[model samples]
Target: NQRVLVTLNGHPLRRGLLPRADGSRYLLFGQLVCRRLGLRVGDTLRVTLAPDPNPDQVDLPEELAEGLEAWPEAAAGFARLTPGRQRGIAYRVDSAKRAETRLQRAMQELEQLARMG
Candidate 1:
């Protein structure tokens, strides 16, 4: 996987390479990225790419791990989610600095996932 710092019309942001559904590889300049930079489709862009030294696929928070351990149905549901969704959940849980907050968020999201399945 590669991590790149992309400059879109002089605005900079970092993003990683993603694997496409058809087994192709691509980089995404998402709507938020474009919006933040006041960019539109067909706008010129400057890109620079390099290998990420400490690239992490997804950093699963301990609280989320424990939540999965405690809820088998939630765990099964979570397992069936797309990698992007799984990674998003992990990132949200990990973003919380406090242990209790992380745990609460983990349980909330996981329970919702379970109910949806």
Candidate 2:
């Protein structure tokens, strides 16, 4: 795996859900590093956070539609958020270990965001 260097010129930071080989999910926070970056589903990446940070090889995880669809309220709240914010929340939830924990956290996030008005 090669190190993915994130520089100041990276465009459009985005986060999304990816799938693991074991059928688990991971939240990927990545940038469009290069036109040659060549990203596809089920790709492994070596990413470095900064100049001094240790590089880690991470696998991309995919979103499970049933998991996301199970929480209709959270989905609605997610839709109401700015795209970046929604990505942030989705990334965080996808990072949870257990399905129940992810759902609970998503519900809490949605409730809190809804109360922000």
Candidate 3:
């Protein structure tokens, strides 16, 4: 396993390299940061520690905001989730390229959390 310092969402995140169940290099970041970054198993990622990669603020784009608004029920349900879960959803959505895909993922996560709840 290789050791490296990495930055995630503007914060310094130190993690260890470990083999995944499928025998790939996996990063073992803290649970909180992992949720905050919205990374999932087998997700490809890049990290640079020294130069912080500051993500923009959490204001959803106009179109995405409209989409989220269209699902008031989902948004309210999401609001009831723990801050960690909320951050997880936000992080995942922010990582998407297309607004539609982001909305879909956010909705999917909301459904999963709802089922768990």
> Against the true structure, whose lDDT is highest?
1
Reference-based TM-score, model 1:
0.52
| Alpha-carbon runs more than 4 Å astray in model 1 | 1-15, 18-57
Q: Write the residue-wise lDDT of candidate 1 on 7-103 in tens digits.
A: 5556655567888889877787756456656778777777766565545444467888887888888888888887667878986886675778888
lDDT (0-100) at residue 59 of candidate 1?
Answer: 45
TM values, all candidates: 0.52, 0.36, 0.37
Residue-pair clashes per prediction, in order, are 0, 4, 0
Model 1: which ten-residue window has the lowest total lDDT?
A: 50-59
- Using TM-score as the measure, what is the rank order of every candidate, best first? 1, 3, 2
Choose 1 or 3, whichever is better by TM-score.
1
lDDT of 3 by residue, 7-116 (tens): 75555654445677888876656554566679777777776743223332243434445645776666676667664455456767666677688778766765664554
For model 2, residues 68-113, the per-residue Cα lDDT tens digits are: 3666654565556664565456657667767787767766676665
Kindly give the stretch of ten consecutive residues in candidate 3 with the minimal lDDT sum.
50-59
Off by over 4 Å in 2: 1-77
Q: Assess each prediction's global lDDT (C-alpha) against the native.
A: 0.72, 0.49, 0.59
lDDT score for candidate 3 against the true structure: 0.59
